[model samples]
Target: MVMEDMELERLSAAMDGELDDEKLPRLLGGCRHDPALQESWYAFHVIGETLRDPQLPPVRLHSRIAQALKEEPTVLVPKSSVGSVPLDGATQRRWLAMAAAIAVVVLTTALLRPSLPANPVIAQNGQSTPASTENGVSDRDIQTFVALHRQGSPLSEFQTVDYTPQTIAQR
Candidate 1:
C-alpha cells in the first residue's frame, strides 16, 4: 500500500529535527507499526550521514524518491489574494472618524493652551521686577548672577587644579 505524501513529508521533517513537538510522538508511533515509514526514516538518516561525510557508503534513494514523486498529484491552483482584498466601506468610514476625532482633540488642546506673559518677571537683587520696567536688572546683573550660579553648582566640586612639574616634584 502506498503511504500518504503528508506522512512521508512528516517523516522527512522528523529526521531533520524540524517536526513540531505536538506531532513528533504521533510520527514515532506511526513509524513503530509502518514498515515503509521505518524504511523511509532509515533512508533519510543514511542520506543525511552520507551528505555530511562523502567517505561513508552511499545508498540508492533517487529511484524510490522518483517513484514517490510520480505517485503524488500535481496542483496548479493560484495563491489566494486575501491581503489584496479591499476594506469594506464601514471600516474605511470608522478609520476616517477616528482620525477626525484625534485631529479635533489635538486642535482643542492647542487652542486651550495657557499663553505665556508678554513681559516676564526678572529676579533683580532678590526682588521680582517686570522685565519691561526701567529699573529691571541690567545685562551686568544677569552676568553676575550666572557667575554666582556656576560657582555654587554641585559640579563645581570637579574644578581643575593648576599644577606644574615643580609642584609634583615638591609633593
Candidate 2:
C-alpha cells in the first residue's frame, strides 16, 4: 500500500514534469504492470484536461479524480440506496404547516395594528380612544392618559372591562 502511494505521488509529480529526468524512464517502465500507477497517471492527465477546458463542470472532474484515486468520492453524493434518508412527507407537511401558522400570526398582527390601542386613554367625553388616532391625538390627551396609566393597573385590566367617566381622573 505504501509503495503504491509512493508510486502514485511520483506519477503525479512526473505528470507535472517535476520528477528528476533519471527517474522518469524507470517510472514509465513500471506503468505497464502497476495498474495503480497507470490509474494515477490517467487521473493526472484527466485533471490536466479538466484544467485546460474552462467549460467542463467541476463536479465531473472531481468524480473522475475520486474514481482514479480509488478513494471514497469526495464530491457527488450517491443517491439514497438503503441507509440514506430524506425528509418524510409528514415532516415536510409539518414544517410547511408551521411556516403557514407563523405567517398567519404575523399577518393578523399587522392587519389589526390600526384598530389596536397604543395607550388606553379615556377621552373628555368619556369615550375610550386609541392614542394612535388618525384624527390626531392631543398632547394633553397623551399626558392625561400616561398619568391615568401610572395610577391604574396594567392596560389589559381595562380591555375586558368598560371605562367610565370616573376613570379619567380630571386634571
Candidate 3:
C-alpha cells in the first residue's frame, strides 16, 4: 500500500518535473501499461489546465475522482502548511500544552463535582413526606383499615382476594 502511494506521489511530482532524472524513465515506462495511472495523469493535466486558465469552465471528472478515492492508500502523509500563516514549533507546543491542561482541569472538575455535598434546601426537602401521603394516602394505613373491615365480616366462597361489596352482600 505504501509502495502504491509512493508511486502515485512520484507520478504527481513527475508531472511537475520534480522527479529525479534517474527515476523519471522508469516512472514513464510504468505509466505506459498502467491504465489507472494513465487516468490519474490525464486528470492531473486537466486540473493544471483549469488552474492556468481561470476563464475555462471546470470539467467534471467524477469517474477519475472515484477511481482515485478507491485506489487511495491508507498511509499517513505529512502535508505542507502553505498559504496560511505558519506557526513556529514553540508556539505550536505551547498551544498543545494549554489544550492538555484545559482537558485535565475539565476532567478533574467533572470527577470531583459529584462528590460535593448536596444543597441544604434539597437535602431537607427530600426527607419530608410527599404531598399525597400528607392527605392520608398511605399503603400501610390502608392495609390496616382493610384488615379491620375484614374481621367484622366473613369472606364468602364467591369472593375474590379483592374486598368488594359482592363478598359482604353474599355473607
Q: List the residue pairs that clash in candidate 2.
A: none
Q: Is candidate 1 or candidate 3 better by TM-score?
A: 3
lDDT of 2 by residue, 59-89 (tens): 2222222222222212223565666667689
TM-score of each: 0.29, 0.30, 0.30
For candidate 3, give the lDDT: 0.46
Question: Measured by TM-score, how close is model 2 to the native structure?
Answer: 0.30
After best superposition, candidate 2 residue 31: deviation in angstroms? Answer: 0.4
Residue 24's lDDT within candidate 1 is 68
Which stretches in model 1 have alpha-carbon errors above 4 Å? 1-3, 53-171
The alpha-carbon deviation from the true structure for residue 131 of candidate 3, after best TM-score superposition, in angstroms, is 94
Q: What's the lDDT for residue 59 in model 1?
A: 28
